[model samples]
Target: MSLHGLEEYLPSLVQFCLSVLRISLPLSLAAIAGFWSERSGTPQVGLEGFLLLGALAGATLVKLTDSMPMGFALTLMIGAAGGMLFYWLACRIAINAILVGLIFNLLIAGIAPFITKLIFGSTGSTPTLDPALRWQFFPYLWAAGILIVSLILFHRTGFGLLVKFAGLKPEVISSAGFSLSTVQMCSLILCGVISTSGGFILSTYLASCYSPMMSAGRGFMALAALIFARWDLPRTFAMAIAFGFFEAAQIYLQSVNSPLPSQFYQALPYLMTLVVLGLRRQGLSEMA
Candidate 1:
């Protein structure tokens, strides 16, 4: 953070921006994933599941084939499959989407360890990834592309309108001749692929390996961020970046051996998120 050093040292502002990107990119993706699902009127509680599965898939595939592209393709395929499965059960069986999501989250908790054990012959995690082999800037580019695409999709297309209608008024969408299943399916698939990428980013860049519990409730954090932003994409994106900054601060604090309780450093991001959300809610009430 000191700017008085040699020209060799990058400016503090530049370093801060990079750290923020590293921390927030995943959250941005997760928020957008939630946005896509809810924008279509479908409740998404499965983001955590989607994210963990993606991380597992990425780590396993990269380990097997030593190809990041292969890992990404395979992760997307698996995400798509999971999304469709959830859609079928939620749509056909009349189960609440939130319940289905909770089941999937539990499913991830069960299956990630099982797979990790089978592959590594132990529990907790796989082998640590080499820095050169880990994904670096690609996920950032992908996140930006996704945000742009989402903004255009929501504002520029009739299909986007249908997606909105489906969520707010299924009868109206149906009357307009749009199949509710189709809209939900598309959104869920997007949600799966996008949300899972959050895990992918965390594993490949943040940790260098996939662990069963690596995400550590970030998916839920993203959900909370979305709620706080009232589903507005720009605000959601900003809030996610803010959360990322706190996470970055946590990481920095950990390294400095700060006198603060380690527990407080760990809780910093979540605490900040709660405080900001409360403030946002209070401001909204005052405006009313």
Candidate 2:
């Protein structure tokens, strides 16, 4: 590319970063949800399901009404409630945490399409949202708030301590006279709300519509980020952003002319994910 062409692309590059930020916000939010759930020793892999469920809920409500914000509000409330209910059931049963989560994912995957069929007369998607109702900065503002609230909840409160204890050392929680049920339930509810909020953000800001499997493995990606960050909120946030950048770059590259096969570009994000995680792991090992 000529210098003049490069100069022209600079503006597009800057715009790309902005898009990365927008995409990263929801991933960070979802990773933080994993952090909360894992800290309570109840890691939920069903986060993908919750996100799809929330997206479905938000889209359905918006389709039925003229208010986008109202749909988002109801989505969060119902997501949290559903999460709490799942936690309650898990506590009463003797299922493996991972298995329980997988079950939830399966359930949501089925239900989302079924509901879509009922509402839209198809098993595919909801209508595109009105552009006027969408805010370009909504994801960024919510991302900041999610990080701040997570910091306060995990680092500065007794509830946070109990939640951490539930994961790190259940005996300590018992010794402190804190019931495991309470901590687990709280963690799951928060996880549900935040993760679903991430879903809402993605549906509104990224896709601008809800569709079957719209989450596209983002929840699992968030979980990978959570583990990559060793369950720390701040580091997980950065890692999630990094993953989002990789995803954004994939989209950008796809739009540009290149001899590379489309399949290569499609695989780029996950490839970069492994590369970034490998680098982080190597660096951590060197430091150790």
Candidate 3:
């Protein structure tokens, strides 16, 4: 608590905050993507697929073009296209949306290695990108900006209301003279576009290359946060930050000497997620 101690602690505190933001950025984005998808009545269980796709697109584009912005732009375009494909398969066809999402995840997982091999002559990952091409703090701004814009769009626009109706009451949307399927498709496409930023950050900001399975279940974690928050955008964001804090702690604990095994520390964030979800379910049961 002394002045010199405070000065030393200040740097550590700042670094921890930065760490949390870096860790949370992707989860937050994915949660928001899930928000849009589920809010519009489409299950987005394939968020993991989108995250991996983004990571691959971002690392590949940045390595090929050597421009971060260009890489990001192309990644978003790919995401939008992927979203359309998902809508066609899940919505347009007679299959169930959840099953379609699961199948999509499996399909992406199976092809990613082949895609990497075809593009980079490697079955594992894309080549490492230039560190200079990697983003640092700007991604935080981008995440924050996306969150704000999404909030505005969802709460302040008629489009948002239509999307909401598409989820909660399709009959209402139909009564309003808007095509229900159109609203759902648009929401899913936006979901795809937004979710890509998370993977882009994973490859461009957190690491230099796209590795296989780099998403490591963050997509599902984001979904849990979204569901726990009951599809509330702001609350989902907060849950993501909380998860990020646990992940940051896990990383920090690994760096310092500790009596516990490394796996325990590594599992800290996920364990925390399970705990939070359990608590939410318990709370709901009690209320019920």
Candidate 4:
């Protein structure tokens, strides 16, 4: 195309890129969380719970205190506390970690309404946030910063090596006289912190309020991205962005006139997910 034609396409391209980034923010963070948890040999099926709780806490605190920074600070604290609790239940108590994750998901789903009731005299949702108070692009910057820092840490630090070994060779860590539990706990805490930030964005930026089940399976999608990347951090993040692009396409398709029903457009992202996973599984089987 000529220069003028290219210029005509530039604005649409920019808008599409922004949409993908916005949709991917939460998924990318959650995928990073899964990377941390699973890299340390801890199964993190309860990421949905983390997202839900973070959304609720973020919306609640911001509504009560009217300070975004304070809301975020308190939300991270809550996430850390949640990490500790998960560690105690799944690690210290000697319960199966997967079972613990499942229980955590159910427990949070059941209790969120009561907590909302106590805080806002309502159940299953929080009050709407002010549009002026809501963020536009700052959270994307935060997510990108986190991705960069995590990449640096994973590639350039001993902690990253230790975490990698914690999953691949727990016996090595134990034989080396390092505390495996401590390593796992630290990873989990970071998992919690990062994943909750996704929820914060979901509640405050993506949506106006925290509603019941607001996570909408993005947590599981994030997990899928992690697995699809074979637990590689950079690959996991890239997969998340890919999924985000599919979602953005879905929304864009919905807006344009098409012969297909709206429901098909709504399910486009999920359908793409199944197709991608199926292809991956088939390729793995053939390799085997």
Candidate 5:
């Protein structure tokens, strides 16, 4: 209850919030991407793959073309294409979507290194782009705008209702003369585009080109947020921000020389995930 102590933490809290906001923007968008695909009755487990591909495409293109805008544009297009490919393999070819996504992740992880070696003729990671080509706050602004638009589209629009109907009863939607496959295909493409933006942010803003597995666990984190939010866009955003806050807190804790082990701080988010999932399962059982 001491005002002085509380004031002392205000700056740290604000910095934490800003870091959370940056992290949340990509996560919320990726969750929304998953939301659309799942709401259309197609499970999208390949968001990570799409993200890696997009990041690679954006960074590579920007480096080659020396235009950040061009890189952004290329990233969107390539991401959508990659998504379409996954849909073809999973939905059309009867391959498991999760497996397909995992394959894509491996492929990108390996391909980036191979390409770096081929192009640069060295074992080091891909080189960074010019400073002028880096993406920054603009992508975050765009992500926030997209989140707002996605919320409205998912909740307020006719398309939203159809998507929900498709999710709940795909056969019924099909019986109503709607093409389920088409809806799913569109959803997959959109998911790819959105998830890829996360990659773009990482590559251009955080680093350049894809370093091996640069996506880390963000794709899975986004999936966790989707489940945590129960596919609701607004709730997804809130959960993403909450997760982001923990991530930022870990950094701040390290900076402030917390007595707790660094590994404990690193493990905090995963611990929270386990707790949240357990609670969700319990809630469902009670409802049942």
Candidate 6:
């Protein structure tokens, strides 16, 4: 490539890397949370619900108390509770976990708007907070730190070994006299807490308080990251960054004069996701 062409692309590439970090941090965390549940052989398709609940709770609580830290703390707690509630329904009531998650997403989607209207006396958006309360990058840093720690815990610790055992052979863990419910419940709570952190990051860093559907399709995207990484934490982290870069590139492309439609540029991330996952699946099947 010509040096001039390379120079032209450098800024776009750098911007893409930053955007990728923003998307990837929460995604990697959510995938790690899902990994824990699935590793224990529990179906956890409800991460989206957990994410929505967390976002709503974080934004709403911050608005109500006018305290950012309290809002974040409560959001994490509520998220854990929400996750545990789903686990109880799935494990104890024998409800399908996927269905339970779907129900929660529907319920939250409806209820959040109503609650926002009730609390803020407005529809579609929440009241704006002070600049300090509105958007903060610290949560992103915290999330990145958590992702690193999770990588260590899952790969290097004895507890990690137990989690692997639980997923691969729940019967074995149960026969060994460990309480499967206990482990599953713990995993669900952890998943909730981490996933909720993403919500807090969104509300606090991107916009203060919740906006309607502010999560957009991030919950599903996070799940996609999980699948793309094959439940591997480090790989998930890297892939999350890759997805972020695609998103950034899409934005950059929209600003430039190209033959492609704007809609095509907008669809790039999801398209890339589908393409990558399809290839990964084919590779696995071929090996099989």
Cα lDDT computed for each candidate against the true fold:
0.80, 0.81, 0.86, 0.85, 0.74, 0.73
Residue 49, model 1: lDDT of: 82
What would the per-residue lDDT of candidate 3 be over residues 70-118, giving only the tens digit for each residue?
A: 9899999999998899889888884788888798789888888998999
After the best TM-score superposition of candidate 1, give how far the Cα of residue 1 lies from its true spot, in angstroms: 14
- TM-score (C-alpha, index-matched) for candidate 4: 0.90
RMSD of 6: 3.4
The CA lDDT at 165 in model 1 is 81
All candidates: CA RMSD (Å) = 3.6, 3.8, 2.8, 3.1, 3.1, 3.4
* Least accurate 10 contiguous residues by lDDT in model 2: 279-288
Task: Residues 1-288, candidate 1: write the lDDT tens digits.
Answer: 455565546676589789889888778898999998887777787888888888888888777778887888888888888878888878767698889999999999899889889988879687876677866578889999999999999879987888888777778877877788898899888888888777777777777789877877778878777777777898889888987877777778788887776677556556765776676635552211
> Which parts of model 1 are misplaced by more than 4 Å?
1-10, 254-288
Q: How many backbone clashes does candidate 4 have?
A: 0
- Please provide, for model 5 over 200-281, each residue's C-alpha lDDT reduced to its tens digit, 9 standing for 90 to 100: 8877876655676777677777777777667778887787788777677777778788888877755655676677777764
Candidate 1 collision pairs: 41-167
Off by over 4 Å in 2: 1-10, 257-288
Q: Give the poorly placed runs of model 5, Cα more than 4 Å off.
A: 1-13, 281-288
Better model by lDDT, 3 or 6?
A: 3
Model 4 per-residue lDDT tens digits across residues 87-150: 8887789798889889978998899899899988997899898888877668978998999988
User: Candidate 5 at residue 65, lDDT?
Assistant: 74
State in Å the error of residue 25, model 3.
Answer: 1.0
Global local distance difference test of model 1: 0.80
Q: Candidate 4: lDDT over CA atoms? A: 0.85
Model 1 — which ten-residue stretch has the worst lDDT?
A: 279-288
Superposed Cα deviation of residue 20, candidate 5 (Å): 2.1
